[model samples]
Target: MNTGNSPLAAGRARLGALSLAITGVLFLLYPLVRPYADEKSMQGAEAMASPAWVAAHLFGAVGFIFLALGLLGLRIALRETAAEPLASRAVVVTWIGAGLTLLYFGAEDFSLNAIGQRAVNEQNLKLLVELTEAVRYNPAAITVFGAGLVLLAVGVILAAVAVWRSGLLPRWSGVPLALGFALFIPQFFGTPAMRIAHGLLITAGSLWLASSLWRAQRR
Candidate 1:
């Protein structure tokens, strides 16, 4: 919206600030979740059912941070780029998808934490076994997993398109966001490899976005 010098420049400036803030928050979330990633905790369905491990995971907190940052950044990015029709549309859609995903993941995080906690304390390994088996055999986990994959896909698509059209960020930055999207899907359906791949993608994307924003300010 001609934000470079328009009255909305103030808002655009604010958006830039918000985006940078979110990027910083996301960076901080990494260390918070690191300590809980012990191998035995996630080894199998049995391990996953451990209340001590599951509750400690605090995975929801991470999802919440991402969701919050994504929502704020989306608002700012869209507002700043509104004049550019293509970028605006892409960003808006991406943000919407990202917002929904944030909600979805947030809910899942809560559910896992709450329910998972009970299983751990109850020592009801039997129930835990059943639930894990359901996740493996029943279609719900598959369905939900697919849904998460779709949200990530949509967000990445929108982000990729917006970044490409706006050229607001370096071409290098877009590369990681694009790659993150590509790797995220496979990671959802794959094994430990997927976790490592998706983790790298998330890290790369966050860094790129943060770097772009920092560089833009310097210019």
Candidate 2:
């Protein structure tokens, strides 16, 4: 039996652990940039116009990239760990979810932000607000974005459960991973507190995963 770690496996474990840690740290800082009001309102437009707002989306975009990469690494790591079929499947699903979410977020961070910023520069608050609402609630966008969010949440929960069952890491880490995404349910209520709480939970879960993977890699 080949018991030693292959170069590719080792690289994946290390990179995945690092990427997850970066993602968690970025998420922890996200609350600072998150707007407290509607993006289309006068106050909302003013908030988005600030340097902090721009930094927030940029940070979030980078975080999404790291998150997707981390998921890919985790999938590869799980495969090398000889995790059960269910665990492998869950990781695969998580990867897909990460990809989908990244796509949605990338658009919001780059395209939407640019348009909103332009509207702000032109002093057209109405256009900025309209654009924000349209992007968020457009029928097609809503469908696809909503699907991505659902997949992300479900994938995280499933992956957590699989990790627990497979004993790939400390089983207790799975609880936070599952509970973190579960907290997202309350965010639909559109409260800042709920959104902040959700982000915190997910960040905690990501950190836990990162720490576990880092330890495993060192071993």
Winning candidate number (TM-score):
2
Q: How high is the CA lDDT of each candidate model?
A: 0.49, 0.68
- Taking the tens digit of each residue's C-alpha lDDT, what string does model 1 give over 27-104? 344333333332224333234444543343344334434533543443344455532455445454555555444544
Query: For each candidate, what TM-score against the reference?
Result: 0.64, 0.81
Best by lDDT: 2
RMSD of each: 4.8, 3.0
Judged by whole-model lDDT over C-alpha atoms, candidate 1 comes out at 0.49
Could you tell me which 10 consecutive residues in candidate 1 have the lowest summed lDDT? 31-40
RMSD, candidate 1, Å: 4.8
Q: What local lDDT score does residue 26 receive in model 2, on the 0 to 100 scale?
A: 79
TM-score of candidate 2 on Cα atoms, chains taken together: 0.81
Residue 217 local lDDT, model 1 = 38
Task: State residue 41's C-alpha deviation in candidate 1, in Å.
Answer: 9.5
Model 2 misplaced regions, further than 4 Å: 1-8, 38-40, 80-84, 118-125, 188-190
